[model samples]
Target: MTWKTKVNSALEGITGYTIVRPRPQAPPPKDTPRPPADPKIDRLLRAPVFVLSPVRSGSTLLRVMLNSHSRIHAPHELHIRRIAVSLTTEPVRQAMDALGHSPSDIEHVLWDRMLHRELVASGKDIIVDKTPSNVFAHRRISTCWPDARFIFLMRHPASIAGSWHEADPQERPMEEAVRHTLQYMRYLQEARRRYDGLDLRYEALVDDPEGEMRRVCTYLGIGYEPGMIEYGRHDHGEFVKGIGDWRDKIRSGRVQRGRPLPAPEDVPEDLREVATAWGYLQES
Candidate 1:
């Protein structure tokens, strides 16, 4: 007999069962349409804002600036999309179904409640979550809060990759940085294409903080406050790693000028398309 046959026969004789490996579970379906918000099921938190951006795109700076506003509370990156629920038992699943709740619906309720709690605790009229990874779940976010607003934060693709590599050069080499950060750029671009939102660039924001803040305030239907430009005076929580930008530049507590954009010729071939699309490079 072959080695496999012998091993299986021996295992069956010893344990009364043959070796069986479990099959890999498939990923959940994508873009499943969530029902529009129902008054009875969803409440609390109105016209919440989301800053969709890639990693190392200066979202933290924007967050703190907006947070300094009297009426806006831009909190640290709250990765609510990563939070999930599981129907562990049949009874629990049945109960949810009886209540006309799908798994997604329950999770949406939890996400809403969490943000509402934050907004209430801060005593602010508006809440903004600037989690970069949220670009992947733009659809779900739009569905969860029909009145949600978005700010599409754009940075030069070459700058994003260079900064990402510098953030952890040993772990993120230049080559890998382009590949990894490009995913966010693509998703951010797709969200921009599919959604209606204000587009702001990292370069312009730093060069003209007051001008951009005024524009943003206008979009949100609020008067621009001068304090937003002086965000260094506010206590915007701990500038720790992971949740958001935790580098010295962010810790500087000022709107520092962004790095000069790479020349068109210096832009990496891999990033050329996106850089041009984002208006960082002129189309030939």
Candidate 2:
């Protein structure tokens, strides 16, 4: 690579550059003082909301509905928890040093700054990041932003355990499915207990998006708009890449609620207590 190319690639972690035209020999135009950036936007580091859940828990559906709102910029799966975790370590600092950037500079350029740009593009001020696996990273997020709010999206453990590749789990080992469900339950239980957030059930959301989203908007201190029901009218841009099951449903512009859950036996005995605690029945 040429020296310029090498330099650009090495500094790619830095913020994007802007170009300006040279002023001609004529006197420069009178300099008008620039307006101060909005204080709320300037300090919008903490996410307004995170739809934290496990796979197939209807997070995409909820995101589409919320994104349709005029003031909420709910985006697709960013998987930022992993990035959030990495940013808190020494390696991220070392990489920033190599790129001639500071820790906050690199982090701002990558995460909060990018989200703010997207939020502005969407003509919204609130950012709602929906990454299903973020349930496991609640502590990390809380540590970074003590006021981080979450929409703890959940489905019945048996329903999630029974779903994989859109396939019926009857042919697979039930133990493996139950194991995965148990882990998510543990995380959800802990997150619900530890954080300052809302617990929203996927079944309830899909059942009545209008009512659920109205409550959600009220919780987030935003007024509800009718446009949220027309989520399919918007282009979320690869919002369903890793979550294909939701693509058609989101595009259809209609709420698709979950079916009757599998028998209680589908959930492992150990997880029954969690299910009950979360308001799902323990019986088959």
Output the number of the TM-score-best candidate: 1
> Candidate 1: global Cα-lDDT?
0.91
- The deviation in Å at residue 38 for candidate 1 is 1.0
Per-residue lDDT of candidate 1, residues 41-123 (tens digit)? 47577889999999989899999999999999999999999988887666887798798777888888889899999999999
Stretch of 10 with least lDDT, candidate 2: 27-36
Give one digit per residue, the lDDT tens place, for model 2 in 37-74: 34254345545577778776777788888878877888
Model 1 misplaced regions, further than 4 Å: 1-33
lDDT for model 2 comes to 0.69
Q: Count the backbone clashes (under 3 Å) in each candidate.
A: 0, 1
Name the weakest run of 10 consecutive residues (lDDT summed) in model 1.
27-36
Which segments of candidate 2 are over 4 A away from where they belong? Answer: 1-43, 84-109, 168-173, 243-247, 282-284
